[model samples]
Target: MTTNTRAWRWGQLLALTLGALSSLHCVELPTKSYSCSSAEDCQGLSGPGGVSYVCGSGGWCEAPAGSACPQASTPPTCSTSNWCWDNPLSEGRNLITVRGRSATDIWAVGERGIALHWDGTCWARILPGNSQQLRAAWPAAGQTWWFAGAGGSLLTWDGANWTSQALAEQVTFHDIEGASGTSAIAVGQAGALYTFNGQQWRPQSWDAGTSPAPDLLAVWPVSNTEAWAVGRNGTVVRGVDGGWSRVSNPTSVDLVAIAPGADAGTAYAVGRGVLATYANSTWTASSFATSTTPLNGVWTSAGVTRIVGPASNIFVLGSATPEPSGTSQVLNSIWGNDTSLWAVGGSGSIVRRAGGQWSEFPGGVARTINAIWGTDDRNLWAVGDQDLIMRRVDERWSPAAPPEPGAFRALWGSGDTLLAAENNPTATGGSNGKIHLFQNGQWTPSASFPSNGVNAFWGTGLAPVWAVGTGGLIRRRDEAGTWLTEGNPNTASAQFNAVWGVPNAEVWAVGAGGAIFRRDVSGSWVSQRPSGATELFGVWGTGSRDVWAVGLNGSAWRYDGTTWTQVSTGVTQTLRAIAGRSTDSVWAVGDNGTITYWNGSTWMPQVSGVSENLRAVWVTQTSVWVAGANGTVLRLPL
Candidate 1:
């Protein structure tokens, strides 16, 4: 598609400096369990928020407590100051571009201003204090690396300190390349072209002769004096002798990426089914693919050409033998020399091409998490879309061993007994609602129940389990271990989202259209209405007397064993789930990364470093855990 600039960012440079490390108090970290004989084995080890680690006396890795880890220098505009993504080690965010000077020293940047680096050991994430989409990078051997992204972000990192320059324009820079540390060219939306010559940045004008100029997506610098940038609708421009101008038309398939060939004046540009090359001072375009398979990136080194795109498609120019990509994930960018190569793309996918084989490195799950529960930090479980179930054992997160796939929307467990509630909202007639029971090391579907979807679960310990679901379906398991249907409290057509209570004594389920149902002492389901609230999605409490329910439009309600009353939650974002460690340590999370804390009296907001809709929250005595869209899990110290 032809490009027109949409949402833009104009940012002021906010610089932060890192201090040298010194003797620090050690904090025993959870087990990554990489056995080390010396300190070097733990060098590249990092945890959430890039928490630094060191080789401990036990021949294991541990974190240096209170050490300075790079975080946002700006004070959180919300309630609390510390919130970090805790799931999918390495990095869970999608990687857009990859570049490096060597196999070990590599940089991959992607959505949400996330940068990952490989230091001859393991991948470590670096947060540059910005959350905008980053899609451009430039790497020069033995020199500082350059990264440009959305919000006019331009920054440089020297493996130690960071320096940033605030570009005045409100545009996203898609690609940046330079000949030396001093000279570089960047291009982005609306045909933006900027040149940096060591001292400062100066805008270079280029005309597309259209109302909205095409986006300049990729840039390749052959030398300090020559470069090329390509983008939508055959947008190709060249820089030579300190001037920039439009290039001759070739293909109009929206060239996304361009790469230099084996020699000067030789390059390749690729897009949907089209591959265009430049040589002998002329541009040639041809059908590179039999079908319209979009090629996202192209690279060439010492006569080897590799093109990559969606579904693990890797093609070499003039060769029919396809590269053996071990992963089926889309590849966004490729860079390397003759000896080694690397490609990164969607869903934190990174694959290495070395020893004539391609292998994907282990990364985190990228699905939307629906619920999070656990006994402590060392043992936690999270379930999300597509039957994704991840477990944290000894503080290290990994997918549970074939936990039998199921869409679990609510999870509750204690000690060895855990239950996962299936999120089925489309029950037609029979007892189609389902649940999963965990045993040995895997999860299996339970027998049967009413409704098609079970949205929530609650119980005393494990024996008497209570569940609620779509069509206001409710069920109970008695001492005889038999699951039986319960009354729907006159709201059988509305879907229930959450359930919590004492097994047989009391239970509460809340869901669609502000519907709230409670099972009283006499074991009869009754409406908790006059609820005066919006669609409620979650219900929780400290005990039988005090309870809380949260839902759409930031609605919050409290029950003191008698009636449910509404409370004002300053913000208006939809709240999906709520949890608390006690009366004063309650947290509710919802859409747009919303996090609010209830410190006994008033509810306040906290900043989560993500934009995916937050759906679940779990609070421990010392920390708060929240899970949501895109396998997002955030942790903040209490």
Candidate 2:
């Protein structure tokens, strides 16, 4: 018999047994027959093998013996109200460098040979037919462009078509600069530098005697005869009289980028926490005020200088303070015209600076999504690594202000009240847990909790919220907004990964080594370790008697009042989260974008187009939402 047929047979046997037990115990049982408008409504029911029930042609639930279960044959459709994958335009690809002649005409290149263009209104990806990472791009007069990257890949765009140019060896090209389309230079690993003479590229030899060759990172062409290249270990080279010569070094930090200043013979080079200026043929180094963030890109136009780096730091020359772009994304390249400035970085981060303020643009790129919660279909929040938080409003996702500078692991709330659990890092390379309350459109630190990392939260949005985390830690938030430490049943410490509760009094926490705890009527946590030693990551239930927990090694357990039984999931991948509309209908998501459904008697896998690790799952009566690594948000019909 087929899988569905076997499942149906088991269900029928179970239903018959339950029916008999209900009569003996004076309990109620659902009738075997059901009315339905669609197959989904008729699913999760009990029947005999090869006699599974489905929605008939007349729209009523009926058994069609020996028929196969319906299969998901096509890709799930994404809609504002239905299933969809919401991510940035880069599709989780990191954009390394961006260049544009104007705000309307822009091009960005990054890993996997991804190329994107902006035509004043929207961005579109252009296929380059390669997957190697593209490291640098330079736009030369009118539609002509140059892209260089890994494996010695060099591509030239001539307004209409892109053609690859061969090189002698595979080497990464870091940056490109040009005085004109014909007179340009590129720099890369191990002292690699090349010059383009309008027709072909030629390698330039630099003499360094017996010293090691420096990896050139950036080049700035003030003129064909006078250009500068900066690289590792403070190696600086000046191109003069048609040859390259070593220049005096100011600091040993690896210089990443160079830009010309307002006057001739004046320029600025920045790298790692050090900013250097070259004037009168001498370079001088100075520390950026109160900034330890490594600098990546520098630009100067009309004497207005801007430097961009990690943590969205933007330092303008002559300004007393550094302006924060309000994002924690690492900016790789910065460029713009007189009216606007753009920076691209890790996690599909793209921000624009105009009117003396920086604003982020929605790219739908995937970043790691660690936790997700929502009050309704539209008002949803997702948090992840690098202080990333996003909120959905009117079907559009936008970044929300981070509660604090740390990775958020869990969120729980209802209506306008919500709480977030964060792992705040310390200077000594460790982390501690903290809680933040969301109120009046902002997130603020809540009462102090334990120092251990908080991993999960569950409550009714009222007083007495429960949080579980490292070291078997359990804390409760009372109605008076004070956090009180609660003792767990386990004398030995265990890491708690997830928590779910029916109310303030009855709660369940699951974690490492198959550890499970439930709060007793006496307000004490008692160990309820089920079968197996697989680490449990998520827990949820329809009621106290129908609780379910999913975890490592594809382990899933269901609690039926008195006993916990193992449910066969048939896969070994770690299952992260579980949600359900009823005990008979449930869903679980996990690593490798795995999504499995439990229909009464059997568990089956569903195809998720993505391949990232799915970390969390949430379900309602009609919809299911999943969040995963690289900001992947997927919604589907329940």
Candidate 3:
């Protein structure tokens, strides 16, 4: 099959920035927990806005507590000023494979063509035009490297920039291997090959005539023709001078990563705890002492072969010795405190490891911790599921006492004043998702909260507070503690997940369906919307309109007062929170323990030790704090 090198067109940068773009709309109620049971449930002044949410089994919609707050339904007002704005250059990142020769030369790759490099002291991001999912990367020489991914995407890195290339066949590029910088090859879906010369990338044609085209995932090349590729359908292929031919593989469970030993025709491939070796054209399969988990990448370093998968499965080859495995949950994010590590996942499971021993934090309530952050190990916080909030203290876990018997989904704070939000589980419970503040030790509930659940909130020291929630809930509190509400520009129900403020008046918030709102000098909220299905989750700002917001499905937006624009962060991993002590030192955390840094403009990915669901982030001049489910707490160096 002839592979075509598609020309680069002006494509959308997959990176999401703070307040990049947004739209306005009234709130709509879903039919599930946060959903609506009837049309009247969404009845605002504009009829059923679809923002109606069923308030448990009772047929009443949860309206705000107030007089003349219609028994029929209350109006869904804008709630932008009460939330965190987006990060202008904060991008979503999932560090799938972390490999390094030295501390300064580490590379991690993941979905959305994300390729991030660490240079000992700091991290940098490289974006290839293709948003195709990237799987693995191997540095061939100085700065020259090769990466493989979906859509048959192949990329080569010269000392400076990344160039997109094509494979011999249009298959998902999975793995790459070579003896040195010059003799490297990449393999992917089907028997595909693309070799790298010193200058450009070109396909290496093999005349196998596309037999069943097994889903090739990894490749290790001994010589040019004496190369091997492994994939799904128990497929293994050997490359000869004329073409690539399939060899018999024992298992069909999709080999994800592979590595060649020091000798030619000697290699190892791994998938779901199944390890196979290829020698003299025959494949021999064996099981290791390692847990039968899905292994993603394998490598042979210093004569020892190690394999890593989603749950930190580290396996050895020569002795078949197994190391302790990481938690096998589909971890959404990760964080660490001075004494604890936390990993949150599906269900309300929050796993914590303190003193090198892993355990589950007992929140009693099974709720997902979507975001986490705090000042220190003893002052950590995590927010998620049904408005859940968990806190850590001296390595002990405690439920961050709920504001009400409601769900607290997002959180933010500065100093002793803390602001938390509630996404009303049922819209009919007269709990329009209130914003609660922990000042000193009292849980003070604010008036005029959200007409629905509050997704995220940000606060300065204590004097004034900003909170945003479901249904464009934009409410602000001035020095006098009076709640001011604003109307959204759009009629659709947009859920703002995050909010941030520079001062009492200069504030911003971001939300679902690409909705963004900004507060002017006069302390009034204005609506902004970007196009697409981008759902903004977390927001932070240096000033009034200069803010950033991140959200579901890896969407990020940036606000610059006059307009909102999107920036590329390479990875499409869902980002949950944004925090920066200074303009050049911003930190964002999210699902899969994604940690992306913003050097003022562009967002770069960083390694956050753990891969659990990180819920929130707080950064000071010299310290960074992240919190997550399972009592996960993390503190970073300045």
Candidate 4:
């Protein structure tokens, strides 16, 4: 036999004995040089399993069908940030229940009647019927689903259409389940229980005429003769051998939700961080140490427990398995001083950053604080719903007495004096537009606005504050207690929303439809024409020689004392507010969490990494602060 053939036979025998060897193993090899321009030209290089070699250009052996090989000297490549996945936006607060067949196929509903689906990778938000929270979901045959929630809300999804159904009683429907297409039960607040028999939903006959309101939270069905319902004040009702009986819970706190765990016969109920296991006709309570921080949701899947709270706090409980972690800043409102910083948002979230590290502050209020402002590092104020006004007196924040129950739109402060403009809730048959001033340790109501609603306000000091609102209302205070109307800016159909002032003489008012009015040294307002008709919302100036204005539809303009010139912002998002430490160092913020910088001649976009609507920007020599809806606040290094 030839030497090559003998070597091939021995190699084949070796490979056969080593069963671990894969089919790609070669039996024989002979070295020979071949020339080729393309893959098809390398004929003799084919191996037994279609493995072949090709030669091209510089004549190096390579895989028959592949791109050029990498250089041997090339180093490995990597990226800095993960840049792969980010936190999912919270569609609603107070998620009461979540259920899914798989990791990606899940549904969650909560306060504001919000419903969303998790399709394994990301969440796709769905519009549930009402703004009231949906508490439970029951999936039936043929893609039919039923949802129950606040105020007796019942909706059915038949794979295509979602229609609301009226219940017989006016109560909050909390839990629902079914054993078959014709047999279903629903229970809710006020000891309400309903039964459905294929054709219609009707009240279930019960003899507990003197039973207190149940406030039911969940329901489960084991079979035609066995079911359970759990609810408030630690109440549980069980169906035993075709009969119903009441049971007592160890804890008096409300049992918010319940579900069967790994063993279908075993069930669990969760309430106030306490979990109870029910199995084999007995119940045992266990304590789950959740954060002192207020929690909004608790969800379980595949033996894992996930909890979410304010400030983007998502925690996975259960012996530390691999899960998503970290606090993503869902900033709502932000304020900064020369030495300290603060921000607040959803779920009474409060964060403070000092010397470059952020920590959660425990003394935050419960409402969503919408506006934040301060005179200095020692004192600050945040305002929001439920008549909220929190004050930072020294290093800690305490809830202050809120002003009248109205939505606070704009806040401006100088020294210890402050002025807040509220959107008139009475105008459209709501509250009348009014201004509240904080001076001498008291919040006093001031002159009412001429227009129906206030939009924005800006000023240098306490007395000469300027506030603008709807219907082109301009209220000015010049060292006087009264707010008087200045000359109506002749922008025809535009409604002014913002006013910026270097002083009484050099004030600029901006609003919708690209209207900008400049007040010269005589307090006379003159309209500045822009190249395009886009609404302007914010204006800032380093001096009288240079000023910049930013607004909707990606509009930004600069005025150099003589003429106004359009500047390219490199973005189409609406710009809402502007602040600058110098003419060449200006920052503008707006809708979609946009931040644009002016570097002497060109405007460039910076990565703010947020999607909330930024309404205001404030800058100092060392830092910049941006504030927006959802209590979003972001600060970047100067």
Candidate 5:
């Protein structure tokens, strides 16, 4: 690899689009300008992805190190803020449940006390400082809101402060709802049911003579006296006048969420492979032909029914039109009436539907980054979760058009041909494995893969890439563009995480149980375990005789063409990915922001400045990039 001659600047990394990131009203940027007369005029100015601006000679705020650049060889001194965020424009936190009075006033809550408020125009992040995984929220219009979650966490937001109330510490509330500040209801595990009536909290008996009281998962409140709760084994109950009675359900699958329909006596409920409708006090059920993933939320208004579930899937009844949700993450909860709709899901995904179409809110592409790859400083690819293929071309990051619906795991490019391993969860039972090819700006599905999910890709920068994934399945794509399985075609009980090739030599794959497998000349697999670690996440090598592997608990090992020996790295954080520029320089990154380097001698630790787990790392001549959870990317100039 050759070093990039152009001077790279921090000004380009500062092009952060601050759409809905900060919770503090002060740090939140206002409507800004795009032109500038001097560098001082561009100060404190930024765009999407939080990328800051610099004054160019054209009297406009320009990115990418400004118009007049410095020589890459003559770099400036490093700043304290080395690692920074580059995508989603904010700290992307998973939002599980959303509630409020209307579109203008909204509260979307997630685990670990993460919440956000939408005031029609802007979204502000709110971290309540509670580490417990929150499961439910009842945003009661005004300042007063209710929250309950794991460990029986029950707290109230009274505009100015959050107040916790005593409750069973072992029970986890899964869902909560309230009519106003005075009335609300929450249902949870182990048939857990609680009621709030403005003054004191009370535990209500919800069995009404059912066995073990099926763990209630969802609750809907019509009035203080009338409420409905649903749970496992298709259990549904109606409470009136302080008495709970069991109701008939059409399916045995667990009902996760329910919503009243447009009609007075109509309702819609969805869950695992089950969709049911209730009208005139009778229940009927069916399943989606195109989806088997559990449906999480349902909404109905003005005779229109909409359902949201895994894979950012959204569809409306009557029309049954599959709307592009702009995300591939699973949607956990959806809200709104007919014209305006909001669906929040995994990894900070927020999408809205209006004017008979769906548009994104810019938080979905930052889902857990699994892998990062690029051939040059001008081109890089990051792929993960629900069809996310973000490309950084010419120093700008944008998403490529997604291929067939699936969760992308690994990405590699050879010349103009880009290959991505996609876990197609649209299948019935589990994910079906497939490889997608990106050429000429479009993604096309390749032949079917043997495993259920592909994890990593490694090979020469040419045809015949080696792919390894779940089920201990190994496959290779030859020059003819045909995928041929190399290992046992039916042996699928184990999972492989990473793979590497030795040019014209053997291929190596590492996975759980410290499994190190090498393909011989005859294509036979030989397993070796020099370091009896529990799990190995990544593997790479400099040559046929010189190879390295990193895995659980900071485990590292090197092969001398004969055997593997364990090497100590001095840290216990699990290393996920390993990449090297040569035998003299290598980098490994993993959990808790751990970044270690091998200087052809001893292993040394480097400061990452963030605690978010780093999953993927890429080494180039000028810079090293690390990607991980919460849309974090740290850059260290080499």
Candidate 6:
């Protein structure tokens, strides 16, 4: 076809797809074809929204570049103090190890080459070019730092730029400790050990008495002549007389971290539910009366000792028991001065214990958000596993109580009245589906259904609510606040996943095995199965005639007041939820940080910058909110 003719046809197609003629003139097309064999050939071609065109599989330039959405130039404004992407006061990345010269100069390292520095007030991120997970970090002499991590990543920061070092062998480095300006010891997986002596890093060999070496995880250097290293399978080695010798390991747990104790000739080691102390050349098992969580890092200073572990656990010796931290994220590393202590862990969790009370910071709750609902952007509710419910008020997310303890599957509501569907297991080895209501700042048990599980919820308000679940179960709440079971209409038993509707009794529910049902004015659901047997997980629409459903294997279907037609999403990730503000602008999120946007005609993928599974999405006129596994919460302005 001629270039002008094709452009005209494309404009017409977009106009028809959006059901509007006003947007027809905005469909800018290239006058000449860009020659390309792959998508890279079309790079830098100007398109809408400062985006570049990409070469499609058909060798044509497609609108919207394959880059992440543009970062906000300014941080979001909120009435209350909250953590946003641009204002990164709190850590949102998993931290593995922490070290510092003093309280004013602290460093924490973690996955994705994350390095954070604390300047006595707040934390700031330092980007190391490599994306490898940094497992260990230590301070050297005078503003110099050393970092070792996965894939043989050994980096040195000379108070300015980070430089990578070449090593003899390519292996992951777990721990590094500096004894002096010219000497340091590092250990890693599979018994790999190396020492840095001013000029270069050289491999160190140890004599194993006919036993396979275990993976070393941590190293602590007391002096040039005395150092200790701990590893998997209860391996503990001490350095003396310029040589390493095996020390008695008291526990079989894989020792992850070691630290000096309160006094001389005393050290502590902790790992997988085991804590051990070495005193006067003898090892003894130590125990904590309160916790058994797998410990990761230990630190001691000013006659005080602290141990941190999974589930936000921090045990302080010689201190009274404080309140529970109330966070579920695993604590990976800890550091402190005499008066204050800080712990970091999975999902960007950072907590501080000061004045004998543990208080959580604003960043890093890595719990998967299964469902999100709100009256608007500021007033929102998100539900997830372990009875986790969060409320976003004035842009900050805080914990909210659920009616009971169970994983929530879906949430929907209007002003002042919200409902959550939960699948609570019964004592008889079966499931009990319950609907919890939130109103007036409290959560209460509202209703229960006979279904084994409740998966999705939809409602115009509190009066007429619909819930779908396993085995083709459907239930509804009428205006009289009474719950009633609407029998399954599908011929086959399909697990319903999501439901959405508009006014006038037009509701659509989609589920596994390609099951699609719609409720009529008579309150009876009728099957509306489309071709193919793909399991659908999410459904939403701007109106009755404009609806979309997404499912497994990148399958998507759209309804335009007629038969449902399949829409092609280039990737095959399992999409879990979809939301939008208008017919021409919609989004769908799924596993492995997949986010696809429907720009009126085609579904284009957008980079989320995370590898966690996204489970739910909520949209407002000017913003989009997505929640997913590992306490991940993302927001973007429309």
lDDT of each: 0.70, 0.72, 0.54, 0.57, 0.69, 0.70
Q: Which candidate is the best by lDDT?
A: 2
Q: How do the candidates rank by TM-score, highest first? A: 6, 1, 2, 5, 4, 3
lDDT of 3 by residue, 170-218 (tens): 7776666665666666766555666665565666655444575666677
On TM-score, who's better, 1 or 3?
1
- What TM-score does each of the candidates earn? 0.68, 0.66, 0.42, 0.48, 0.59, 0.68
Residues 1-638, model 1: lDDT tens digits? 00111111100000010110000101112323334567786776654335656755544444454332333122222224588657544345778898886666778889877787766544556667678888887764356788888888688888776678788897999888777768888899898899888767788987777868899998888888888889988888888887778887698888999998777778999988899899998888889876478799899876888998866458989888777554446778888888678888776667666656665543335566788876445445687765555665224344442234356677766434456766544444533556776543334566455445777777766557787777667777665656787875386776888888753467788988888888887878888865467799988887778889999999999999898889887768999998887788788899998888888899988777667799988776567888887666778876
Candidate 4 lDDT over residue span 493-599, tens digit each: 45776777665358778887778888777767788867685888887786666878888877888888888888889989998888777767788888876878888
Model 5: residues with Cα > 4 Å off, grouped in runs: 1-95, 116-125, 158-160, 168-170, 287-292, 301-303, 337-340, 354-361, 366-586, 589-596, 604-615, 618-624, 628-638
On residues 197-244, what C-alpha lDDT tens digit does candidate 5 reach at each position? 877678888554666677888888877778778888788888897788
Error of 6 at 42 (Å): 50
Compose the digit string of candidate 2's lDDT tens values, residues 374-486.
Answer: 63353456878766666652233555545555788887765445678888765654458888875544456785444588888877654667888887678888888788889
The count of residue-pair clashes in candidate 2 stands at: 12
Which candidate model has the greater lDDT, 1 or 2? 2
Model 3 segments more than 4 A misplaced: 1-93, 99-103, 166-170, 205-212, 240-243, 262-265, 279-281, 288-292, 310-312, 318-321, 325-638
In TM-score terms, candidate 5 sits at 0.59
Clashing pairs in 1: 88-364, 367-631, 424-453
